[model samples]
Target: MSVLLEVQGVTKTFGGVVANQSVSIEVRAGEIAGLIGPNGSGKTTLFNSIVGAHAIDEGSIKFEGEEISTFRVPVIARKGMLRTFQQTRIYGEMTALENMRISAPEARVSALSLLGGFSSKTDTRGEELLEFVGLASKRFLRAGALSFGQQKLLEFAMALMSEPKLLLLDEPTAGINPTLINGLIDRLKQANKELGVTLLVIEHNMRVIMNLAERITCLAHGEVLASGTPDEVRNDPRVVDAYLGAG
Candidate 1:
């Protein structure tokens, strides 16, 4: 598989604190890659840097062989790359369908236009995605009224509405129950396989990531400690001592 997203010697700092230090990794096209680390290990910081949630202190981020380290979120998103937060970012007062419509790449042109009305194409896609995430019945319900797991599903669908080429997901199963997590995992796999979207996921749930990702990269103390296939990373003594052991 050819490389789709690449991060080389990336670093980020907050005041005196070094959140990420010279990290490098790659995600190939049409593959699921996992990022894992202990608490405060700069997992989310790396995600933010990749998505342009903020600027990096150093290094390069490339998507589809193009430099994007300096690009803003909207710019990167328009290039068919997008990210979902650990916390679901949905409009609470709006219906799920409304949230989906507003999340479209075109909706950023004018909030008023989105609020006023959407074309039939947008409406049809919104409802289809809602059903895709198994939230068809809740499409008309207020976003905030949905359960945490449901909210995450809604956020996933919203991201899908943009037809991204690569998606960076931050702890997708974080707050979900075991049963829901299984369902979510299935949906995530479906999204990757059926929709042909590439995924780079940050997750603390070992079982989930092991099953979901084709390759895994482990970070500790703001640096990559190990990276390989699931079994290789899982058995690596360094990874075990640094992250899996502590977990």
Candidate 2:
């Protein structure tokens, strides 16, 4: 597989505290990769630096062979490296369809125009995205009114509005019912298969990660403890010692 992104010696620090330490990882095109770690292991910090949510104090980030460490959040997002937070960031007052419109970067019309009323182009795009996420029936409902699972799906749809190439999902299945978990996973799989989008997921849900990820990277205490296939990671002594054992 082709390399989609590369992180080399990436490190982040806030004052005297180091959040990430010489971390290096890679994602391949058209593959679902997993990043698993204990809390405060720098999983999210590494992801933030990659997506320009946080700037690295040292090291470099390359996407598709081009350096993007200096790019801002919007700049990186425009380049097709998009990320979603663990929390669903949806416009609560707006209908699901309208919430999707809010995330449509292509809608260059005035924000005041939207406050008054949205354009046909934005409305159409919103509906299309809602349909894409299996929320077409709920399109007219307020985002806050929908069940948590539905809201999560809505957020996923909005993130996909930019037509991202590499999607970084932060703990996507953190808090949801088992029934909805499968639905979310199915949508992610479809996104990868149908849209040809690569994915890097940070998840603590071992079953979900093992089922979906092509490869897994394990981190502990701000360092990569192991990197391998699911089976390999499951059996690694270091991984067991660092993460899988009884606490």
Tens-place lDDT per residue, model 1, 124-222, is 999999998899999999999999889999999999998899999999998988988888888889999999999999999999999999999999989
TM-score per prediction, in order, is 0.94, 0.90
Query: Cα RMSD (Å) between model 1 and the true structure?
Result: 2.1
TM-score of 2: 0.90
Model 2 misplaced regions, further than 4 Å: 108-125, 245-247
Q: What C-alpha lDDT do the candidate models reach, one value each?
A: 0.92, 0.86
Residue 157 CA displacement from its true place in model 1, Å: 0.7
lDDT of 2 at 38: 85
Local accuracy of candidate 2 as per-residue lDDT tens digits, 38-135: 88888998988998987799999999999999998888887888898887777888898877776776543454545655568877877887887789
Consecutive 10-residue window with the lowest summed lDDT within model 2:
107-116
Look at candidate 1 and tell me the lDDT of residue 213.
97
Per-model C-alpha RMSD: 2.1, 2.8
